[model samples]
Target: MKLRTVLGAALAAGLGWLLFAPTRVRPVAWEGPGLPPSRTSGPYADNGRLNTAELLAPVPGLKAPESVAVDAQGRLYSGFEGGAVVRFQPDGTAPEVFADTGGRPLGLRFHPDGNLLIADALRGLLRVGPEGSVQVLATGAEGVPFRFTDDLDVDRAGRFVYFTDASSRYGWPHELLDLLEHGGHGRVLRHDLHTGETVVLARGLNFPNGVTLGPDEAYLLVTETGTARVHRLWLAGERAGTLEVFADSLPGYPDNVRFDGAGTFWVALPSRRSPLLDAGARQPWLRRVIARIAERAHLPLPEESMLVALDLKGRPVAFAQGSGSASYSYITQVLPVGDALILSSLHGQTLARVPLAQVRP
Candidate 1:
């Protein structure tokens, strides 16, 4: 009887380990090399005096504006979780239906040829013509289908489009899992219209949510949202195809990245840094268990709102933040247009544009 009891106990222990052990994720650690200290007290600090009066007035009839793209003609396009693209003219007129994407559209970028390219969570990479017709460019890579097609950027030549796949197991609804799991399920891919080829530029990325081309069009920057960092990929230099950390230790999890005309990159922080998440990142097993349970329960997690600005060389320049109290929601994307910054939220029903001059010196 003693032998049998000991064997049963051993089996139970093994089973528990199998069920609770954290999923093994590749360690993508940044030891502060080429990155500033996590905390700074200079111009980038939160002086608690950011003017958010403009953000109080929201766009009418928009829901969960994930991204905003502006064309050369000053026409603004916003993507929503309802799979609709709404066009807001420059005169603050009512928005009209630009296109019905039939899927959750996350990122919007206009090609040089007057076509709109979209990174859609359900439909994959798509192109919308001038007449509002849609076309699928690519859906899968390396024999694996995309699970969460998130953000994209178009090249100057209008022949290549670069985008991100945020996760393999979840769409936007379960992005918190990507954060807790810390597994490298995200990917950066390129689509070439001339060759009809889709290539995976970088793999094993953790929740790559936003993408943008550099000012010179020589490199691409992608946001690793789960890691609170942005990565750079050389596209034209001798180091072409090489990937490296562009910035790290962001104050919050970055959602979408865009560039301003002044050689600055603006990244939207959907949520503030959670100490619980940071601790889970240090311990793999706990994170996996939390992710599994959260997925099973289908519970909505908490997030914050923030926006950050960085220079061309990936140095933090400015930061504007809001409290996570129930009054405010998560900020998903930021676009710089003229003298205003258009902000998109994943949980709010309207888009917001805050005057740029108010947020910075």
Candidate 2:
């Protein structure tokens, strides 16, 4: 009888914890959609032939450089673990603080006039001048304050900028929580540099990550990471205000978007293809339980290095693969420079550079 009593009590406790755990996850029921079969496998695998660009090591190792931007003169810029935007010389020498966003900076692009624009995850939209002067451009859109400003791109006209707010509910150190929750609380915001008005161009996104202006400058593209697709919004012409899925069923979670001068945009996928993540997306309770388990277990994220280039029509053009045996970790963005591509990571100690010839067929 005492054993029976103990069993009943333990059952109640277990069920209670499952139903009412003090977890950061905000559970939402979602139908885990299918990810298209990865072409990254089989004979189609990109042989990944590029040189890893080195950087000044962060103190204690792994500062997590999430994004990269280069000046015309070849200076590279990326933010470190504590929200410091560090710039390195052309030869990866003379590391110095370019501008401290004080809030974590993710996406970076230089304006036509040589000012640097940043999408700060903690702050908002920002601009860094030549001498390291900093200014806040926008923080909220349509009265919604940004919780995760992830990436940005400037149009040819330079009058407006498009950026992604990864989540409106979850902030830093909790991005995975937002991803696991699968809530469509993300958004794409356009900040008018002239009028200083920030407006939401699209909403109900699933953890949007990187963003870029199309080469034509008539439309914008934002990567919806939670859904494994890119969302396109038309800014001008008759289709203005129209939103559609530019690309879908990607091999893995897409990070930043960058336009190669040769008419393609490069996207980085840090995660290797995982059937477990796909299966968990189908069950809300299962994911919540997994999240709770992860709080203690702290499972490691897969370190597959992948970069895909898509044309304006959202067709995959080129694929570049890195190694699981290599030192790169969670590559976040692939920035296009003249004749080469630069890679950054959210959990890597150095930047990488790959020759364009190897990335293209």
Candidate 3:
């Protein structure tokens, strides 16, 4: 009888804590995408195309190469979780520290003037010179400051830098929490290199993760990861100053997207859609509860690597996935360099690559 009474008391305490835990997440009930198609069907049909991927340049201290930039000389540059921007020879050898952003760097792009632009999560937008000098470019737009400067792209003339602020309500540490909230707190901004002026192009987006310039700089493609959709913001032509959906119903949560300059866009999927997360999307209270618990525990995701290739018309041209025995997972960026696709990840020490020919529809 005594043991039963004690167990009941503990159970009541546990229930009370779950019901009224102090959490930063203010989940707003929103409809999430339906369950994604199985890997063997629909637009995500698995074909073992990425099975031939091979790891390259495993540095001892470098991990989570979330994004990569290749200079004209073919040297590879990437940022890690530890605020380092590392450079590697064209052959993926001789790892060297190029520059340190002193904050988390998410996206990298080289300007026509030979400066590297970085979208740092903590320090906002920055630039690194050819001789390895870091410069603060922009930390906010208009009067509002950025909370998560995620990814960026530069025009050929180096006049403007297009980038995304992943969220305004959450910092890098609370990214997952922002996604859970499903609130529209993201924005697309452009920075003028010549005038040093910053402007917000679009605002109130849901977790806009990646941005890329379309052919001829006519349009910009920004990925809204929370919605599993990509938005097309027209820059020139009759559609200029308008926003539309470029692609929707992605198979997984996209991280970074890049244009190949050969009429294709590659998108990286860190992980497939989480059914558990989707199930609670319409239940704000449940998501808040889950977020509270998630802050203290890790959410396990499937061990599958995926990438999607889309044509200029926003049609899926190819879907690639690693085989079950594949070593690469948690991929964040798929950069098409020459005849190969360089794969970056957020949890591994090595970057992987596969021949472009191996990725077929």
Candidate 4:
């Protein structure tokens, strides 16, 4: 009789725990002031409007175009989540495979010596030689292996390469957890091929992704994807070796950043900022629970799609955005080619280029 009574009590307790235990869906209440708003004018100033007719729809079998780079011969290069570096020629020809990275390639840049520097999410930093040979430049930092190597930028000298490690916990497939945790796992690092040295230029970043060198090479700008801010690290002059916020209060989560010769910086916002993410940052415990539950369920959180252009002073010069409902979903990177802006997507099959002249300033 005692054994029966104990078993009943135990079952009751178990049922009670299942019914009343804290789930991962509680409301968040964070209230800190967000970063400053963007200072530049948007494309609306110039009367820009998206011309859907000009956009090139995806080829029959492409997938998840992430980052883009251009060569001197006017050839466009794009890295894909499917591990292919595809090239598009200026003559409106079909894109051909430049190389198969065998890992998610997020960022691509043409080195002065004709090699391609790739920030591969799964394979770490790689240098693709002119002959298409692959070499790993970096795999870890400070004895800790990289969980996500997101983007890269090569200096004019070609001796220095700067890149971002988006997170230490999540690679591309489960990036939503990084947003939920909001623990500042991102970092920016510089690799010097001439000296065979690697240095952490900045740390404690919030999902740092795209990187670009400023006009004078005086500083390098990095985008903090989770926080919607761009940070600058001075490489020369009085501010040498120091970091400062270049721009903030972005309309959405900033991804890959690129600088054009015409004094504009292009940024890709994969998704709009989620109110839930803002709320979760205030309640660490809630975030922790969400992370734990997310691990168990293998569910992905939501993200938005958009693109914006900013000048050197970190002000918005133009805004080109599309929601998930639109054809452009999860736009990850933008490259300004002549008067057109080349757009890359994280969840779409094709690459797109919109004419800047067609859009207002």
Candidate 5:
């Protein structure tokens, strides 16, 4: 009788904590892109193609090479978790420190003038000169400060820098909270390189994580991680200043996207969509309870790595994926340089590469 009473009291206290505990997440109820009926069908079929990925270079203490950029000379540059940007030769050897942002760097793009632009999660947009000098370009746009400067791309003429602010309410390590909240606090902004004018191109996006300029600089694409969708914002032509869906119902949460300078756009998906997250999208109260519970416990997330290749029109042409045991998982970006596909991850200790011919016909 005493044992039963103790169990009952413990259950009651747990329920009470779940119901009334304070949480920082302010969940909003919105429609979620429901999961596909079959995970092995359509554009999401697990073909195990990413199983062939191999580590590019393994530096002793380097971790989380989130984004990589290849210079005109084919040298690769990637940012590590410790705020160090390292450069590698074309063969992924001879590692050397390029610069340190003193913050987390997520996206990288090289300007026409040989400067590297970085979207730093903790320090905002920054630029690194050839001599390894770091400069803060813009921290925010309009009246709001950037809470999570996520990704960036520079125009061919180096006149503008396009970037994404992943969240205005949550930053860095709180991304899981932002995702659970389902609040639309993300936006895409453009900064004029000449005048230093920053303007919001699109607002109210749900975790706008990746930004890339489309062909001819006519349009730009940004990934909405919470909604599993990609949006195309027109930059020129008659549809300029408009937004439309570029891709929808992605199989996983997209992290970064890069154009191959040919005809394909490579999008890195760190993990597959979570059914539990989708179910909680419209239940704000339940999400609040879950959020409060998550504070004390670590919620499980998918661990597989997936990448999608889309044509100019956003149709899926190819897919590469690996199970949880795949060589390198949690891929954040897939950049095609020369004949090899360079891959980066936010949780991986080394960059990876796969032959381009092996992934394409």
Candidate 6:
């Protein structure tokens, strides 16, 4: 090839990239906090050792099940992308439509009064009783409506419900975009059933994913996905009305946090961060370009089926990993019932029911 012709082609390609590719995403600048080390050894050395083949309770016609609620009768319940809350048998078979939420549901918790409460991303909070009737709970706090209600937990006495609004700038569809922007529009809210009031506990959270009360119900644990940290909001104590980091430097961005009755806090990590994402955190333009490319390529997701079990004091205790031979990924929550840890996935068709005995060392 002639040198002049080669030079002309290169110039034209560069010109095209500068014009078309740069504006594809047009993302705003967001310098995210430097990510922690990829691996933490102390209590997580046994990560990714769980046997995925043993779990996997099948459900027919369920799509993108992400949250689970085990009723008093051992009935398993989950929310699907199609705005339906389903009830399943103990072994995770036999599907029934417990209630049609008519909006995307993301979190499930059973009230002490036998009511199934839900954090619907599009419809705010909801309550479904055994009669199969659905009622709207709290939709907004501080005079503003909830934009992305993510997860919730009822207090031990069922007096209050703590929940998270993942992002006020993004709805259910633009979660990744919100992450890319590093928007701190997330918040933790409390709904008092007695007072019939919804109030904001804390604001400016970075993609807060889940909310659960502390062991004694004196404080709340909130997962900040963009920061890969968990925070505690004290309600009654020396630290009451104060917020502090409960767990920091997580292995990956956390999604949901749950407290098992037996003193374990089960946390779900949807996926491990990539070097590309880290670089994008520094270069906003690069993140936009990467997002466009990923959407177009139908990329194969990097799976890290990682779940961390934290002690009641917010210390790491156990790590349940299923990286090997696990077809399911993007775990959103893990509820410990007896000796089993029921894992819900954001894009999986079946729920995982790994034995706690197998998850621990």
TM-score of candidate 1 to 2 decimals:
0.85
| Candidate with more favorable, higher lDDT: 4 or 5 | 5
The candidate maximizing lDDT is: 5
lDDT values for all models: 0.77, 0.80, 0.88, 0.76, 0.88, 0.80
By lDDT, the better pick of 5 and 6 is: 5
Per-residue lDDT of model 6, residues 1-361, tens digit only = 6999999999998766654663334455655546555464656553555546344556667778888889999998999988888888887777778888999999999999999999999999899989878889888887778889999999879999989989887788567666666757899988898888988889988889988877679888899987778898898968788899888877778988888767878899878765666666767766666566654564443557778888877888887666655535788888888878888888788677777877775
C-alpha TM-scores of all predictions: 0.85, 0.89, 0.96, 0.85, 0.97, 0.88
What candidate 6 gets wrong by more than 4 Å, as runs, is 1-42, 53-57, 291-301
Candidate 4 wrongly placed segments (more than 4 Å): 1-48, 51-60, 296-304, 323-327
Task: Report the Cα lDDT for residue 209, model 5.
Answer: 95
Give the per-residue lDDT of model 4 (tens digit) for 1-361. 9999999999998766544556443333444227434324543221214424144544556688888888889888887767888888874357788888889898899999889999999998999876667899998888767889999998888999999889876777667677676667788899998886778888877788899998889999899877778888898999898999888777678889998867888888777666566666677666666666675677543555467788888887677654324446577887877777777887767687666764335
lDDT of 3 by residue, 209-241 (tens): 999999999999999988888899999998888
lDDT of 2 by residue, 152-227 (tens): 9998778888898989998865777787888788998888899999988888888999988886778888888887
Scored by TM-score, the top model is 5
lDDT at residue 293 of model 1 (Cα atoms): 62
Q: How many backbone clashes does candidate 2 have?
A: 1
- Candidate 5: C-alpha RMSD to true structure equals 1.3
lDDT of 4 at 125: 91
Q: Which residue pairs clash in candidate 2?
A: 53-352
By how many angstroms RMSD does model 2 differ from the true structure? 3.0
Go through the candidates in order and give the C-alpha RMSD of each one to the true structure. 5.2, 3.0, 1.5, 5.4, 1.3, 3.1
Residue 131 error for model 6, in Å? 2.1
Is 2 or 3 the stronger prediction by TM-score? 3
Off by over 4 Å in 1: 1-44, 49-62, 298-302, 324-328
lDDT of 5 at 238: 94
